[model samples]
Target: MTGRSGGFGDHSLKTLEESRKTYLQSLRVSTADATFFSHQNALRKFFSWYSPTANKPDSPGNTLAEFAKHLLTTLGQSVDTVAGHIHSLLNFLAFHHQSSPDELRVRLFSEIQLLSCPESAKESLSKEFGFQAGSEITRSVDALRAYLRQRQYGTRTHAYVELILAARARPTQIRLLNRSDLHLDEQTASIPLSETYLIAATGLHNEQTVDLPPDLTNVLETYIEHERKTPSQSGCQPLFTTIHGRASVGTLRRSVKLASEKARDYHCATRETNPDDRSPVDSVTAVVPSDIYRVALSDVENTS
Candidate 1:
């Protein structure tokens, strides 16, 4: 349900356009020419988006949420900008004797207000938020760091390790991430944009940038250039790819779990062979491979 106005090869969309024009004539809205033009354009867009499918009738209900998401993530429009478009949409719905988009508009408007907040304000809000405050863990962050530093890393394995270490992302997040999403030069990586809006709505984050460490950036570059496949080769252009497409969650999980296990084993061997060794190794070796969760929990605490 997306195309240029009058470009839909059918008269129904054209009929909708005529209907919209009639509605505007009847609306007596206290708006200027520019505002009227904007509303007209918004109507055109909505009809274009709501045009019937090949085998099915037009179902605006099925597409409204999707359209809003496309506006937020794909178009990357400011919340206010999108809200303006939605207001016009409400008018269009009213004209059609359809239920207004009030609830959906409220949700979309809330999301926009969140995105519009200053970065400092977002940080302040997160800090002040008490609902998500997590219990403090006893895990040693230094130990986690040491384990990460000592682990062996092939180009592919290293990329996953570094991203998880830095992103604190779940294995599921890797496959959803596109090759184009990594911002190496910026030293910041965005999580999936689809996830970002939800994050903002939930007040977990402000949809601002998330930082990536230099070492992680370097590894990702090496993997993308040397190891990852192009879309033509794999059918999906993901930063991390398998023969099929994006790396599967299992594949991503296995590498980290294996690496962490290896790190723990080495730590255990060191502690056993030299029980009293006065090295950072003693403190670091206490954590098991399974302790990765505690590390992630710690990151969530620190960031939130």
Candidate 2:
């Protein structure tokens, strides 16, 4: 491999900064400014994954394939996203070997040319997150509400549930909520536009403000004034908190799911008690945080 004309000369130079710089410089002339930056970013990420500290791959094609698979399975990237990165990788590899002899190009292309995005990965993702119909979402909301009312649920939990049911807020947005975001006097909550970048990362819908219903506002007022603890000295004052201070998005999600589970159990117990009564048994739906958002969306569609 050494001393070959128009090929990467030294092993050290090939894997280090110089090789990457040469490829990026060649890319700059052929690509648009936006595309050049995109390629640069992709290359940076690829090199990071193929770390200088780690053992270098004998076959770059195999490394690329493994990287693509890692994106889908571990990083949870969409197929289109993984495809885009793969395209960037191909360009980087092709430009590096453009000046090399024909056989090198053939060897490289032979391994990578057949690398197509896997459709099965997308199907697996869909199966992992179960599909919830519109009717199921409504039933889930009803069951959760009935459970909260029947049991001695904490004011904080009850407030968040009521706010989502009324405001149609996403779990991320609700989790990011601060005490200052709530305006009990105005009967509204503000989702600051400044946090849009953070919110967008999680695929949660964000808006300027959400009008809270009177009943919902009252529940929040009670939670804030009584149940909520004093803000920590750490500076970030989250609207929702546990004994430890700010509650994580996972905690918020779990709270909603636990309530849904209890509601289903309660409904089942009630039906068993009155089996001979012959009245219609109320529907109790198992739900997650996303189902609540779907229910909220359904209500908006019905009204509009």
Instruction: Specify the poorest-scoring 10-residue window by lDDT in model 2.
Output: 98-107
- Strongest candidate by TM-score: 2
- Show how many residue pairs clash in every candidate, following the order shown: 1, 0
Give me the displacement of residue 40 in model 2, in angstroms: 24
Model 1, runs deviating above 4 Å: 1-148, 193-208, 229-235, 272-294, 300-304
lDDT score, candidate 2: 0.60
lDDT of candidates 1 onward, in order: 0.49, 0.60
Query: Highest lDDT, which number?
Result: 2
The segments of candidate 2 whose C-alpha lies over 4 angstroms from its true place after superposition are 1-132, 193-207, 272-283
lDDT by residue for model 1 (199-260), tens: 22223222223577777777777777687765546344677767766777677667655655
Candidate 1 matches the true fold with a TM-score of 0.43
Q: Model 2 TM-score?
A: 0.50
